[model samples]
Target: MSKKILLSWLFMAILCLPVFAQIQEPVKFKTEWKSVSADEVEIVFTGKMEKGWHVYSTDLPEGGPISATFNTDKLEGAEVVGKLKPAGKEIDKMDPIFGMQVRFFEGTATFVQKIKLKGGKYEVSGYLQYGACNDENCLPPTNVEFSFKGEAAGKQTAEEVVATTEDLALADTASVDLVPLRIGEDTAAGEAADYWKPVIKELSSFGENVNNESHSWIYIFFAGFVGGLLALFTPCVWPIIPMTVSFFLKRTKDKRKGIRDAWTYGASIVVIYVTLGLAITLIFGASALNDLSTSAVFNILFFLMLVVFAASFFGAFEITLPSKWSNAVDSKAEQTTGLLSIFLMAFTLSLVSFSCTGPIIGFLLVEVSTSESIVAPAIGMLGFAIALALPFTLFALFPSWLKSMPKSGGWMNVIKVTLGFLELAFALKFLSVADLAYGWRLLDRETFLALWIVIFALLGMYLLGKIKFPHDDDDTKVSVPRFFMALASLAFAVYMVPGLWGAPLKAVSAFAPPMQTQDFNLYKNEVHAKFNDFDAGMEYARQQGKPVMIDFTGYGCVNCRKMELAVWTDPTVSKLLNEDYVLITLYVDEKTKLPEPVKVMENGTERTLRTVGDKWSYLQRSKFGANAQPFYVLLDNEGMPLNKSYSYDEDIQKYVEFLQTGLKNYKR
Candidate 1:
């Protein structure tokens, strides 16, 4: 009797083991669309979403998913009537805190794009790019080019919309513009457009769609601004700002001529910049744009390069080329005194401006590289060149205005010193890049913030006449510009001080501090909800039967702050969050540490786990192939990787779309 009982108990125990392993299931995500009319297209997306798996919003990471965007482009004789809105059917979701009352289905989600075509037949085609995540991990984002030929609709019905999606045909939006590419002398600035044509075409051929929504347009705008700022300090440009005015004044003996020359200089700069942008597009095309901007080596190199520029600004070194070259260019300009002379003048300006402009140029290369658009870097460079070339161009065009300009003595040095502070602060970012890539974590958020505090504070003091430098001529009285600069630096310091106490500091949250380091924050829109442990959060996600969102963040990550403020605050964004996820913020810079003594092998060294950030960073590098902040992931309740992970973006709408897709995958 005892032996029989034992055998029966053993069988029951074995039965329970399989039940425990039932915590997760593998899920696949697939999307399809149907056109209801030339003006209205319905998206019928299906998620082979597995049990206990979930994806996230389009707003999840800035670039993780393509925003479920609908557009009506160039309707020859047509006008876009309206925007695409979601009134769709979805998979069923089971959750307590999030996604509890949501109606979702594991197999399909339907979205409608309503467009009122105005009186003409046009080819209507667009792309559908979404970031999908399953139970364990999120997948790298993929997009589809969807297209259709529909006539202006006279009428429509719900049933017709549903039927069209089920039987959609291949889209005709597969016209790819491939610029041919050629490898030439390394010294060449870039390859010709013909060189990249084949590459762009080939990538476009991979799938019939071209959707690269990961990069935010704001970044491009910012690139323009930074480029302008860098150009302002270049010697080639700055000295000429006044000299060019004098030259035109001497030649025409009219203030107006100088102004015209200055204007010409500015115009030439713009032309140069725009051409550079075109060249970049011609060389790399669209495919390389995405990788160019977010590289660690690029950032580090840029930072070091900036340091060199800063040193030059401090008069540590003279960045001039051989006198022979300058003389040669000058001689050529004298020989050809028309546009070529202007061009020669510009050439001289460029050579002279190298010291001041080099750092900015380097920054352009690094930041522009992050863009997925072939023209991004060039466009960015163009913006800078224009800014640098502006003063001379405008002053030459109106030479009389040059008299209003401040004398360039002590003020110039002061400007250089102020910029040096910025240089130092920015250098840490590059070092942080290296640290993150190599698993150093030496310049993590708190440390970074601390460094900025010091650099800026010193700048403020220096501006206030409390400090002196090697080039000082004894007069330390503060000018208004210098005062303002100092004040701005101090204000920045004040802004970051709150972060050390655990504030999110949303404005620059992406780049300032990691969320993990934040003592108090509310990423979740739900009121009064407190989450203090990772396991608890995961359990809640499991019980709610939704996916867990693990946010690996840190203090001093400028991009992170920008993302949180710019994206997470949107209304469509917040509502979706409350409905779909259990948010877990892991601050890679948090000072918290493992409770007991723990030693782990990292980068070939067995080191004792030091702080909270150490553990999280170790996990991030070991698992996710990253060391940057604002990293996001969607996992099943039981901790399986879902789809490919996404990085970050600055757009709120796109982020919202990312989450919606993640939810669809989770339900499946």
Candidate 2:
């Protein structure tokens, strides 16, 4: 009887053991509210997790870990302005169980949400659902209820209130600061008085799109391939092709071994170039590369570097690596056997041809480094190396083919001189970028167009044999290819002439600075927005009974300019943007500083919003969860989205349809 009683007790203890483990709470929550404006209040939720425990962020992907979610009990009197933002540092790690990346907060975490009050005061009740985990175990999902009272604050005198309300109605909180109105203002002078008010737009996230990143990689790769083809024609590289292949063919007894050795040499060249690219990526990192691409100092340095390269191409000097470096590699090739010798031979070729290939490689690297992808440099180098290596391997396999190839002559000098002029023209582009970014106004649109016109005209004259550099042949007659190139250059020069007098010159718009940089203008593209501030544009839209089109753009954004010139310039799209919709262009790269800095919690981290650009960037990220430029969003007067957002697509018909759809939605 005693043994049976003891067995029953043990069974009961086993059942209760699981229940005892569930009793402890590993995380605690606290909530509070702060007033931002008369109509908007910010609700902050802070979570404190026990030691060795963590709570997942709201943005974590599903099927990996449970994320924290927030919901309001009632949506009648108040509405959430944007997504719930994390207010503390987050730890991102790969989850062993789920086989994916997960972001979680350890220790303490804070989240914030903006709530806009429609009218009268009420209690805003909400519940946060979250899951906590530790190294050993994960607790079951839990919910914590939270509530905060909302009240309109910052009420002013009747005169102040009237002025403040009017200003607020016309101001976008994202990019502009609100200015208090003065009492006893003249009604006739109201338009002038309104200029002083600050514009505001709610801040959001500015993350880069994944698809755009992939597209950038493709663009860089193509650019590098073209650069390599151009490099192959330069005086330094062109002369070596026949000699390198012949050396390999004569050195080996067996034809098969010669072909294999030549192939190995080409592969070695690719490895060397790709390794150089990898070294650059490892040294600078993605973020630093981006910064370097845009930095004024770096741009200026590149301008100088290209200028030096141009002079070298013009025969002022030869830009070559150390002779000893090439000799050392050449000696190794002479001594070593098999693949090692072939690789050293290829290394010698690279070193000897650096005068021509170095500038091209440098330019390509600078261009590719701006892309968001870490492997962009490597991909670009791969493309270039393939183009550079193809000739050597192919020539080796068919030594007879060398007889059909153009003999190295004065034609190589002509190619070098042409590249010199081209390099000079491209160098101006980097200088222009620096000028525009720093607001120096040194390279204005008119000046830039004038310089380009001269450069191309000179190039045309040079191609026509009217102008001669140091190494040009005395032949007066131009070849058919050279004549056509001269004609093309002259045509391009003539096209740019009209741009000085304010022509759009849409073909080269991506390379040129903004039209706003032009001091004089005759042809107006009509793409400029009526209002750049969101609230001001929306107010005008409401009064005119039109929908709002928000253009998220940037001064530094190349694709934004491309879209403007290609798609927005279309008559149908232009007409809709001008008449049917209230266009608001928010420049995310605007350099204007905010009158006062604002520090706010974003994605669980505190960041200082110190400029107009930062505010708009934050607004875009927080409100729509988008951070890329050339992003467009259409909305009704009450701030509701009218249709899906648009990105860097240039299909005019699609853009027109997007506008029409938004207009149709707004009407409904």
Candidate 3:
């Protein structure tokens, strides 16, 4: 029950944790050599061992440590021309831990090598890599550096031959040199290479595409919280609280009854959201949810769905249940038929608060779909319920506290206006989808920056009473939140102003367009780029020596935004994108107009391509049989799929595995 006791138990549990009786040692590489015959120097890679564990046999099909690899230093007089043969025997059978026979080892395994010597001495260097695993966990294979001396025949007596060790050679375990996205480059002028080049390199190698399947619950819970927060801020919801509490007091004139109803209302909110979350989880199983997250079609649909919600946020219109449904819910609430009325009251609360909570709910639901955890949506709803229900319970406990919150006034309108700006800011994510779908590239890097600048600038002006909406209440002075908001908006707008001219805007780069597309000045300094265009990126994917990593991304994809924040920023994974693979970022919801003759069918719906997004959407839905951004398709140099396509999520490990599998598959 106590923290200390719990921690002690946890530590003890870890200490006695059932293990596969594996050995683990700080990966160390040592060197040794011997004469196999007259003219050959044989290198013996005796990877030192740590007690209690064994390195896995490299010949693992189902599970085991990775194979130990040996490479030779570019030696002048010596060359390695034979395959590495380890001194071990293969044993495959059903094991207790592994349902299938898994490759494993005990103590140390030696990889024997024979190198023919020509005339002189030379140093050969490379790495020996193999994963070591206990019954509980597997440490990823890492290369330990080892080297050996090759001498001309008769140069040294057999007695002179001695074993030696060397410092660990850096193994390419998730090794990616992330050059930040930049302009111009030359390895020759090392001192002043285009700074942006390094930056681009970094951006290109944005690390581990998350799998998110496991953390579905976290996303769902977060969505619920966002919904509850939005519900709290709504004009209608905020005003009703005091009125409802007053009604409860006046109706019964009993403080206890008033408290009871307030608690009931809050509990009702929690029940409603939790039920909704549970219902969704029940309807969609984990595997289905995984499909939706990775499915390109679902992604496009989600992107479009967000656009619809954004439109609603911008006063386009309201999407609601039937009028009769609301009336029925209201009628039930008014009936006062026992505690049932409270439940009805909660239902009515949801209906009435729909205008405010609708977007948030939509956003939350879309997010939960990716989690693939049955409870994720429910968890999200729980978070939302807590945020919404907290105020009611807290306020009822201290009625006097109601007086402290500013009386509902023009400030409420200020809140709405501020939310409107956020709505617009989020709207661009949808447009970005269309931008990427079609090849127009209309909403390029700098353009995205400008729109953000304008949106925030307008928000700043509105805060200063320079702008008003149709529903705005005329107010001469800004309130506490409004003033702070205005300052934030103004400063943020100012921060982006330079981006239009070509600033890297690292502060906001994750959310902004790729640096290659920005037109800017400092921080991301560049000598106007001569980089190839989007078409070239695709061609490069096909022509390059390495494979292509096709990123089906959209501007308005919320999960795509999340993926950037959660996954791509990981340093270990980002380097792979920047270096080994050619990245083709395709936007599926581009809004730019097509030149001509762009017609297509998507989901059996016939359409003409007026915008770039249309074509891209069509391509994804039709050609690729996918409709998701954050969809990754690994392809060989010839543009054929090396492995099955994978979708995005919060699990970086699975994503890394997918990438690793693709590379391994191709190498085989």
User: What C-alpha RMSD separates each model from the true structure?
Assistant: 26.0, 17.8, 21.4
Better of 1 and 2 by lDDT: 2
lDDT of each: 0.53, 0.71, 0.59
Residue-wise lDDT of candidate 2 within 2-70, one digit each (tens)?
Answer: 999999999999975521111235677766666667787677777777766788888676444557777
lDDT score for residue 413 of model 1 = 64
Model 1: per-residue Cα lDDT at residue 326: 74
Model 3 C-alpha lDDT per residue in residues 234-257, reported as the tens digit of each score: 775788777776666666777898
- Compute the lDDT of residue 123 as modeled in candidate 3: 63
Q: Looking at model 2, report the run of 10 residues with the lowest lDDT sum.
A: 162-171
For candidate 2, the per-residue lDDT at 69 reads 72
Clashes of 2: 23
Best by lDDT: 2
Query: Which candidate leads in TM-score?
Result: 2
Single out the weakest 10-residue window by summed lDDT for candidate 1.
165-174
CA displacement after TM-score superposition, residue 235 of candidate 2 (Å) = 1.9
Cα error, residue 94 of model 1, in Å, equals: 35
Count the clashes in each prediction.
107, 23, 67
Error of 2 at 95 (Å): 38
Task: Score candidate 1 by lDDT.
Answer: 0.53
Model 2: residues with Cα > 4 Å off, grouped in runs: 1-215, 436-440, 527-566, 575-645, 651-668
